[model samples]
Structure formats: C-alpha cells, structure tokens
Target: MSRLTAIIAAVVACLIFCLGWLAMHYHNAASKQQTRAESAEQQVNAAEAVTSNVLTTMTIFNTISEANQHAKEQIALDASGASADIKVAVASDDCALRSVPDGAVKRLQQYADGLRQGAGGSATGKPDS
Candidate 1:
C-alpha cells in the first residue's frame, strides 16, 4: 500500500508539470502569432501610403498635361488666323502692309493671353482677335 501511494504521488506530480509546460508553450505561440499579425498590418499600411502618393502625383501630372495641351491649341488657332489674314491682305490691292502688321500683332496678343491663362496666371485683359 505504501509503495502504491508513492507511485500515485509521482504520477500526479508528472501530470501537473506536463499541464504547466503545455500552457506555457501555447502562450508563447499565441504571442508570436500576434507579433506577426501586427507586422503584417504595418506593412499593409505602408503599401497603402505609397499607393496614395503615386496616385496624387499622377493626378498632378495629368492636370499639367491638360493645361499644356490647351495652351498649344490656343496658340495654333491664333497662328492659323494670322496666316489667313496675311493671305487675304496679299490678295487685296487696296490693303496696305500696315494692315497685315496690325492683324498679326492682335493675334499674337491673344496667343499670349491664352498661354498666361493656361499657366494658372491672370490674363493681361487683351481682347481676342
């Protein structure tokens, strides 16, 4: 009976130790998992920030490109009109060379105004030719 009692005590002690060990092992694993999750979340946030910055830059570039295109079109239209006026002046016998100069100047002024507006600047209050 004494030997049996001693054997039982040893078994109970071993069982308690095993349970404690298992609890500590599980706790460590949970902590490691939490750390990994937090790291992944931070990485996701960083990636989102980078994507946002890239989008903003692209938007700005598109706006600038649109402005440049508008300016170019305005300039081209003015040039075409000036050319037509010169052609008409050449065909007319009564039209003086001074008349062609005036028309050309007016068209150049309009082109300058368009460029100013496209550059986000105020126009010089010049009338369109």
Candidate 2:
C-alpha cells in the first residue's frame, strides 16, 4: 500500500476501537444507575410499609384505651349506686351499721379514686375530653 493510505487506514482502526470502548463505558454507567434506582425504590416501599403498620398499631391502642375508659366509667357508676343502696339499707338496720367499720368505707372510696385517675376520668367519674 502507499504510505498515505496506510496511515489513513491505521487512524480509521484506532477510531473504531475508541468508539467501541466508549460504548462499553456508557453501558456500564447506565447499568449502575438502574441498579441504584431499583435499590432506592425498594427502600421507599419498605418505609411505606413500616409507616402503615405503625398507624394500624396506634389505631388499635386508641381503640383499647377508649374501651377501657368506658368500662371504668360503668364500674364507677355501679359502685356509686351500690354504695347508696348499702347506705340506705345500713341506716335502716342499726346492727349492720355497727358491724361495718368506717375504715372499710374509706378504703373503698380511695380505691375508686385510683380507678378514676387511671382511666383518665375526672374525680366526678366522668371521662376526660
């Protein structure tokens, strides 16, 4: 071959090799970016699932707390009504009033007060807003 043609042919081969190398580099970079995007998407999905589970757990706790408060209110009411009935019955019987000590009644009242406080209710046995 002539000298000029040989030089031109060598330049063309070099150009083809450089283009192949560039294409391979670009493909590798794109694959790495796709992998990163997939990992980020998985992390986001996991976060969403955790948030939903926490919300559900909080809802259940609230439901249980409200039920407990309602039961406490009912118990307080029943206790007070029974106290009034007992007082009336005891007042009518002199012997029974002498048998029931005053300390026992005070202890019972203290127990009811603790129940109201624990149930988030007022001293009047009403649930707090």
**Candidate 1 per-residue lDDT over residues 1-129, each given as its tens digit:** 999999999999999999999999999999999999999999999999999999999999999999999999998999999999988878766555455578778877767777767743325444434
TM-score of each: 0.64, 0.66
- Best candidate, lDDT-wise? 2
Worst 10 residues of 2 by lDDT: 119-128
lDDT of 2 by residue, 11-129 (tens): 99999999999999999999999999999999999999999999999999999999999999998999899999998888878687565579777766766787757744444556446
Question: Clashing residue pairs in candidate 2, if any?
Answer: none
Best by TM-score: 2
For candidate 1, the TM-score is 0.64
Report the poorest 10 consecutive residues by lDDT, candidate 1. Answer: 119-128
